[model samples]
Target: MKTNRYLPLVGGLLLSLGSQAQTKLATGSQKPMPAAEWIDADTGHKIVRLTALDGANESFYFHNNPFVKSLGAAGDKMVYYHSSPAGKQLYALNLKTHQSEALTRPFARVHGEIVGKKRREVFYQVGDTVYATHIDSKKTRRVFVFPADFKADITTLNADESQLGGAWGSDAEKEIYRQYPAKSDFFNRIYEAKLPRTLFMVSADGNGQLTKLFTDNAWLNHVQFSPTDPRCLMFCHEGPWEKVDRIWTLDTKTKAVKLVHKRTMDREIAGHEWFGADGKTIWFDHQKPRGQTFAVTGANLQTGQEKSYAHTRDEWSVHYTSSADQKTFAGDGGYPTSVAKSAEGHWIYLFTPEGDHFRSEKLANLKTHDYKLEPNVHFSPDGKWLIFRANFEGQAQVYAVEIAKAAI
Candidate 1:
């Protein structure tokens, strides 16, 4: 069947211009693997479980690059996490065939899903040691290990795949984590403590050369390298979203730091910042004053020109993502207990930017999904579907909801 590419746009416009209801999943809806795919009852769209793995499968964090998108004739592969009885490991799913290739064995505390698409490899950390594995060959190599004074998690890989960027938590921040362990226990306390944190990068050539970029007396985190500019890096001041000036850019060559978005209103905030596909824009989940309103806002990295697309409270998502071409956007909606305290926000949304606001069309109903494990959303490499991880099927597994309305 030929899909109408323009059909979804039409559906989005009608819903945005007229009336719409909060889409909800069927009671105890279960579209587990082996079934492969199912039609979302509320939205009439095809939703597919990416891989039929038997363990708890999960996708990458919202901003981290997971897909080795431009693989030419070989097609793209998405690297994700899996934990079974054998061991917790990393696997690359063949988007074309739905087959998975194991990339790593069981390792302790593997951090970040930083894919060096250029090198055709995935980079991660086991404590202070950084490792890179070949996507196609399953061959692994030691990238580099951070020194004692600069040990930190690997966050981003530079455009040319030369440098891996990250932030080192301060002793106070580490102590808070050590004592509290869980994010819920330490998140607030560390932020309020205003502990010192350092931003750094290490060479992928395995020389173990640590480049300590800079330090600040605030929680520095979410470090990302510009996808287009190897010398340019982006990070955030990790704290309570409402209280922090979150988005920032750093010039690796010059050691210059600039604040990306300055809050205009009293309680205005911008966080969860990520670089556009071209690396020319920095986009984030924006709100005028805390949980009152929501929008996905973007600021031109060079010109500082801002563009925002607003949505209703219930349309708000824990994380939002832009397609590879930057032409479309999608979000994995929030739950009732989310900070927005949404009454009905259980839909996986497909958003079309209609000037100042988004023309949103519900793609999948996620009413039964757990909110604790955030459904970090990403657009498929071909922009045909929105990929996200959900626990709605009783375990954390990655799924994709077709952007166009369809039945499988």
Candidate 2:
């Protein structure tokens, strides 16, 4: 859709005013794949099990708005960080054979990207340093390292595959945790400190020459480059949704920064922002009075226009993801905690947003477990499949749903 075509004053805004839900039997025959079972869901989609560990530590979820792309080679392989009793590790699974190859082990909290046109190599971080490992040879190389005082967190590769982007907070992160007890234990906070928080864009190879794109006193995070515009990137002020403006965009060429979805009211809470397929519009979830109500919103970065649909009451998602075309969106209400406290029970959902209205269908009903459904929900490059994390079996696992063209 044209970015400027959604202007409110021009009578062009598409507004979905309220919430609704539907459940129906899914249609589709099961595909023959190893270590996998298929079930027909009420959304007329087929859900495929990518992993089959029962009551085991099978989590593949990484983080919300992750900088790394998990699916590789047109959905033939999926790279994910998994935690087990043995240790935390990274693996790549063959979608058809159900066979997985370990890429690295003894790794700490991680985010990874599969590189090259052939996707034979992977790059990931093991703390403050980023490393690259060969998928077949298991040989590794150190790609980049942050300053001794800085610890890089989430990482992403740019559109041209020439640069990598990431953000790190100053030493204030430790003091924040010490002074305030975090109810969720997740890293979302805005503290009163003078420590420097910087966003870096590093070269993808060799010494990985690093470039500081922006820095601020606030917590900077979720650094992602536009998929089509290499010089443009987006980051967020990480904190409680209502306390921060939350999103901002930066131009690497001109070194300019612009606030995205800037607060327009006293109680508006917006976060989990991401760019559309064309980079013309940005999507995020917004609500007033915190958890009471919310809507999935889209804003034109170039024209200053906006549109929203899929409204809901206290039951909306804490994070969301949409297809490249912006025609379909999926999310869950699960918070960061384990399934016991923050489970969605209703599980994942798919929304088909139309001109001022939207239709929602329950895509997957993930029963309660030790893991909460995460917000890594994403569509394949071709939009033929949707992928997400769930713990329907006890431990978290990744799954994909074959999206029926007619469903959207």
Candidate 3:
């Protein structure tokens, strides 16, 4: 195979054969091998026990966006949101029993992180009402609602609200910062309420003891909390009069404000990646004038020194995840499309182009400096099975290969 470093710009064509072939397994007969499990990088044990809930008949007909939004592994459950004709609905899939149930009824959208263990809490918006549902109990309670003309930007919330950096006592249970439509002159005012236009925090029990955090005439958008500390909140303050957007961090304890990063007239700074586990390092994509994209870098709380990882024209982003013992770093790598790890990390997943098809390789023991494997590799959580997601015909599916003996 030729080792060309550039990412292929070819049109979207599903390549079959080679590692993309679907194979049947013995243990999980009802589920296809490719869809059955995902190898855990840490222990090499198959972590995600997947089963096709719907849309399995048309071969290619599977979950369009069936990505797992939140995995409730501690509670032996998982929650995912799927787009439907009515709208997007949240579904709870029990991992142990392989049973599925719908948590939210049709109407409104469930934005932000879905919280909970066995019984999870889903923060969703309908019309003006913001509600939370306990998946196990099937109990739905109205948390808050938007005011008449107010709109909430759901994208502002972090993956699990774990990175909300503000001076709040605990993570805001049901808090949303809102803005009015573009045309409304009254859109600039900040309020603490359910929805419409409000920025307030609620108790876990749906009690609205709203406390006004800050009120500024400037249009505040994209409110995010620091991944390391909930008290440090960062938001973008934009106004019609201003030319460029400014990012600000608010110290909840001191109520002091600091300007972290600002953009000049010609360049705009966007894509804020707050390293949740490591508070200091923030990674973002920066577009250069030469038609090349560079991964902009920042420091975490501990390091307090800004640094950039190795540059690759293939395009790369940092995945903020510590190893099993938090001693090593691991993240997804692009360009060649693979997962990378720090020096001490054991497992590395890579994809190498083999003519028209691609092969997945698993490299172990970086310390020895000698590690290699065949393509289409998947590492189980316990390092027992290797599962691979492949595309066949016009359809994409998964396949698994036993790696328990191979790992030894």
lDDT of each: 0.79, 0.60, 0.37
Residue pairs in clash, model 1: none
Per-residue lDDT tens digits of candidate 1, residues 68-177? 86355454778998877766678887676455777887466465688888788888877778898888987888888766776578888898888988888876677888
- lDDT by residue for model 3 over 73-123, one digit each (tens)? 422444544444555566654433445567775456555443433224655
Among the numbered candidates, top TM-score falls to 1
Which residues of candidate 2, in runs, are more than 4 Å off?
A: 1-45, 54-75, 106-120, 135-139, 178-195, 335-345, 369-375, 404-408
Q: What is the TM-score of each candidate against the true structure?
A: 0.90, 0.77, 0.51
Tens-place lDDT per residue, model 2, 295-344, is 77888989878888855542365566777677788765554342213334
lDDT (Cα, 0-100) at 4 in candidate 3:
14
Candidate 3 worst ten-residue window by lDDT: 56-65
Of the candidates numbered 2 and 3, which has the greater lDDT value?
2
Against the hidden true structure, what lDDT does model 3 obtain? 0.37
Full-model lDDT, candidate 1 = 0.79
